[model samples]
Structures are given as C-alpha cells and as structure tokens.
Target: MTDFDATAYLPDDLLERIRSRAAAVDAENRFPTEDLAELTAAGYLSILVPTALGGAGLGLAEAAVLQQRLAGAAPATALAINMHLVWTGVAKVMSDRGIDDLRFVQTGAVAGEVFAFGISEAGNDLVLFGSDTQAVPAADGSYSFTGTKIFTSLGPVWTQLGLHGLDTTDPADPKMVYAFVQRTDAVETRDDWDTVGMRGTQSRTTVLNGAVAPADRVVRRVAPGPNPDPIVFGIFSVFEVLLASVYTGVARRALDLAVAAAKTRTSKKTGRPYSDDPDIRWRVAEMALAYDGLLPQVAAIAHDVDVLVDHGGQWFPRLSGLKHRAVVAAKQIVDDAMLVAGGSSYFQRNELSRLYRDVLAGMFHPSDPESAHATVAAAWLGPVGG
Candidate 1:
C-alpha cells in the first residue's frame, strides 16, 4: 500500500465537486445521489474486489486510505459508500481465506449493484452473535426474514440488503441466518432520517415483512452466541476500520480548518493573529498531536487485516479499541477545533458547524464506548466472575 495513490481514484477535481455539494446535500437533508453516480462511474465501489473481476483490485489497507481521503472531502458520501464496501470487503476477506461465501458480493460491486448493511436492530446489543429478527426456513433452504432494521445507510439506492436473523423453530439447535435480500415490496424503507448532521446519508429505518433470500443467497447459518465465524470476523474488522477512517478524516478536516482560522483571525487583546497566541497554538498543536496517531493506527490495523495477521482472541479487543480511540480522539479534535476557529464557526454556513454535527454520529456506531471498554477490559482481565 506504500505505493498506492489514494487520490488516484478520488482525484482532486472529483473530490472538489463532491465537497462542493456536501453543504447543499446536508441542508436539503437528502442522499448524495449525484455523488454516488460519479463515484460509481469512477469504479470507486469496486476497489476492494479482485481485478480479475473487473474491479480496482485493492485491499482493505488501500481502502482505508482511500476512505479517509474521500471522507475528508465529503463525509456523508464516504459513509454512504462504507455500507457497500463492508459487504465487498467481507467478500475479499472470505475469498482471501479461501471461503467463497461472499464472492458474489465482489462481483456484484463490479456490476454496479449497491449493497446495504442491515444487521443493526433497535435493541440487539449482542450484535453479530445474536438476532432479534425472525428468519423462517423454507423447504428450499431459503429464508424469509421478518424484522425491523434500524440505521440502514444507503436506504434510497441499495440494490441488496445484507442482514441476519434468528431461526428458532429448532428448539435444540437454532441458528443465526446471514443472507442478502433483494429490494422488493417486502422490504419497506421508512423515510425518517432527519438529523442534526450527516443528513446526506439518509440512513433510514427498514422493516422486513417476510423479505426472502433464495437458497443461493443464504450465505451462512451459524450457532448463535460467540461462535468463531469468519463472516463475523470479516464484518467486525472491515466495518470498524472503515468507520474509524471516516471519523478520522473528519478530525483531520477540522484540524486543518482550525489552523486556517487561527492564522487569519487576529486577537484584539493580543493585537496579533490567533495563531501567534500561546493558548491558541497549544490547542491547535494538541488537536494535531491527537489526530496524528489515528491514521497510523487505522492503517496499521487495516494492514494487519489485509495481511491476515494472527491476533488470535485479541482481534476483537484490538479492532474495538482502535475504533474507540479513533472516535474519542476525533470528537476531541473537533471540539478543540471549533474553539480555535472562534465564533464564526458557530454559524450554519461554516464547515466546522457541519463537521461538528457529522462527527457526533461516530459515537453511535458498533463497538460503542461502553462496549469497547468492556471488550478491551475482558481481554486483558478475564470476564467478570471468571
């Protein structure tokens, strides 16, 4: 990945266009449809798929770098694409390990099919290990999933919805079903994505009323609760790293804006530019120092994933900890950045105002602060009560 050019796919001109539309998209609270079309045309969605399959033939490390670049320009657009990349990334992870369960996802990316992540439920804290949705098995080995999924990004334009549900008909050995449901009448996307920031994502709630996945699309059926499934690993690794990349990018943008503001805004009390003031300098430096470690950490973990490093049981801890640190560091950077930018940043037109709202969404993604601490603590000091 050292030789990789992240901006090659994104390009400066393309990102400038995407960046230009971000504020309007946010103001209108609509999905970045034009941005998606432009990226789709650029083959940005297929970067992680193998080149033989008509993709850019990149790995997760390169993807992490590219996402950071894209997110810095337009966070909502990058986040909207993250859902699709998660599926393609999982496909790559499986194919890399000789598991072809999700190879179709890679090919689908090349074919311009959009994949939406639908694993999140309203109250399911067990995440990948358990499901509240019902997956009824049919005689043909297909499943009809009936449940509600919340926070489904790319709600308006996804071609496929990848989700999981529980099949409880078997009293003794029920399984968690992982499958992809095509867009159909059974899948209803509610138009309820109004938010303070990242409005362009339009991550709405989806209700599945007997949404069916054919036998071929039913990729996995694993025993629920802490099973060592490869899909689980793939999802956790790719999702956490990419999620961190977007937030880290936002932090980088905030830091840049802070530096720009400090160099221009003169302090009346000191009769000099804020950048020359010791306190402002300290705050900006603190923001930079905190932000600096995030990219390297993201790149290191993503590289380890790409290279298939053997982290063993510690993988969960490492992935969750990395995400936690990145998000917390990002929030801190944005807060300090707003202060450094002075009062002008409080206006809606200011980029910092939008970024401040967008960065808050990072705290709600999977491996949340509480869960991350619990995960790391359990790894170092055994779970409570042995």
Candidate 2:
C-alpha cells in the first residue's frame, strides 16, 4: 500500500474541490478545464514519466491507484485524463524494457503536452488490429492521415493525438502506421459531445483532413492485425487497467454514499435508521463484497504489468476480463446503492444519480462484455469451430 497511496497523490482538499465541481461539469456538459489545469500543475499528468525526465517516476500500479482516487471525485475528469495517461504509461512500459521509441511521449508529457488516444473509430471493431484511416506517405518520410475519429477524448485540449492508420498504397507490406500528430488546422474538432453521462469529458468527433505526423514522430509500422509488437502490448495493458481503475473508483464512491445514507436516513416502518434495516444492511454488504473484490485484482494486474511479468498470449484475456468485471461490478453496485438510498437518490441533482449514469458509460469502452467473454473463451477453448 505504501508503494501506491491514493491520498498521497490526490489529497482531501483537491478531491473535495473536484467533487464539488462534478455536478456543474456534468450539468453544463462542459470539459473540466479547471480540474485538468490543477492536475497538470500538480504533476498528475506526468505520473508515469521517469524522474530523469522531470516526472513523478511512478509505474502503472501507482497510476492505477491515483486514477481510482481521481474517479471517486470526478469520473468524467478521470476518464478524460485517462487518454493522456495511457500514452505516458505506454512510454514507461516501453522504456523499462529497453525500448526508447516512445521516449518523446514521456518527454512531451513532462513538458505539459497533452496526448489524446484517437484509435477508436465509428465501426472499427478490430480495435488496434487495423485502421480505416488512411496513412499516405510523403516525400519527406512524413505521413498525412486522412480519416474521421470518434470518441476522441481530450479532443479540445490535446496538443498531440496518438493514432493509427493503414498504409495500403504499399500493397506488398501493407503496414499499419502508429503515430502522433500535433493539433493543426487540418484536424477538426466537432462540437458534439452531449452524452447522457460523463458529460464533462467533451469527447468529440475529430476529422483529420490530412493531419501530418513528421517522419521522426512516427513510432511504428508493423504489419496489421494481431502482432507481438511491444507497442501493442503496452497500449492494451495500460489502457485496460487504467480504464478499470476509473470505474472501480466510481463503485467505491457509490458504496460510501450508500453506507452514509443508511446511517442518516430513518426507516418509516421501524422509526430507526436504515442502517438498522436488515434488507438495507444486506444490500450494502453485497455492494461491499463486489467492490472489495475488484481492488486487489486491479492492483495485481497493474503491478504485474509494471514488473514486466509476461502472461504471454493470455495477457489480452486477463486484461479484458478485469476491465469487463470492473465495469459490471460498478454498474451493479451503483444500482444497489440507488435502492438503498431510496427515492431521494432519484433526483437529477443527487450525486448517486449522477454516478448511476456515469457508471453506465463503462459498458461502452473497449474489451466490452461481449468481446471480453469472447477473448476469455478463445483463450480456454481455442478458436471457434477449430
């Protein structure tokens, strides 16, 4: 626990401030600009970058703990910031294993440059395996990316976007280019992020009209589809674990609120606090059981990633499974908490109601329930009909 103290990174005062603003941010459907500014000034953005590069020099496990704490206060802020952290985490993972390819990413983060993940597309279910975006090579070795990206978190504030595209012009090699493009006139950010939950994220659609990534900035050109490239592992590991951390934090908060309500709210039937009601106590206990189960699993997987413990081909299944369970558990915990809190939590102004909506967003993230089950099944049963 000493290695990863959530409070050490996000103290009470900062969390309270973030929590106080969560409602307004969600109600307005605006980005938590103040939250990001405070976090950046506090060096939260560079948690995964090495100390040599002026960062906190932390690892994925520590980042996970911090992310959980952040989410407890502001799920939208935490989720939006996750896109930036994912790049820095990948840089840390690669650097630890002697790959300096992502050194620039670490340095950029330390310099206060925000990097957003732009891999998710409209219908690209292949995830990182392939890309519908076009990567056309230029005379100077740079590539111009032309395509539309969806759910691009940090879209408005990101100075750099980490994305992937297919370079089919070279029919022989057909490489999938993974690179980062700085914000430019060519990159268009649409004002269309009005969602039911996590409204503060402002995750808008981005149209890349030949957005350019200079030659030196282009990181990888591996063949498309499932490959053993370190970059892929780094991305998948960091993304899934950090994403899970956010929802787990949400569950923790929901459980805390339910317990508090049980102690304060009186039961009409017995004229005693709801805490004295057997049904209320049982529901809270169920929430605690589920919430407690997720913490250790998230910590263990994140620690394994930090220590470079190779799970081989099983890594995807494990990562996806953890994410899937965390989301499902968080959703269930929130639902139970709503019942425990009774009709009071049904109000739009109530924090639990906000959390209930935010937790629903977990289902839409990558390695979703359907995909996670397919992955775990494939790991045990092999390919379908093989």
> Model 1 scores what on Cα lDDT?
0.94
Q: Which digits, one per residue and each the tens of the lDDT, describe model 1 over residues 1-386?
A: 77898778989999999999999999999999999999999999999999999999999999998898999999999999999999999999989999999988998999999999999999899999999999999999999999999999999999999999999999799999999999999999999999988898889999999999999999999999987789999999999999999999999999999999999999889889999999999999999999998978999999999998989999999999998998899899999999999888999999999999999999999999999999999998999999
Q: Which stretches of candidate 1 lie above 4 Å from their native place?
A: none
Candidate 2's C-alpha runs over 4 A off are: none
Tens-digit per-residue lDDT, 1-386, candidate 2: 56456676788999999999999999999999999999998889998999989998888999999999999999999999999999999888889999999899988998889999999999899889999999999999899999999999997899999999999987988999999999999999999998889999888999999999999889989899899899999999999999999999999999999999999999677899999999898999999999999999999999999988989999999999999999999999999999999899999988999999999999999998889999999999999998
- Estimate TM-scores for all models: 0.99, 0.99
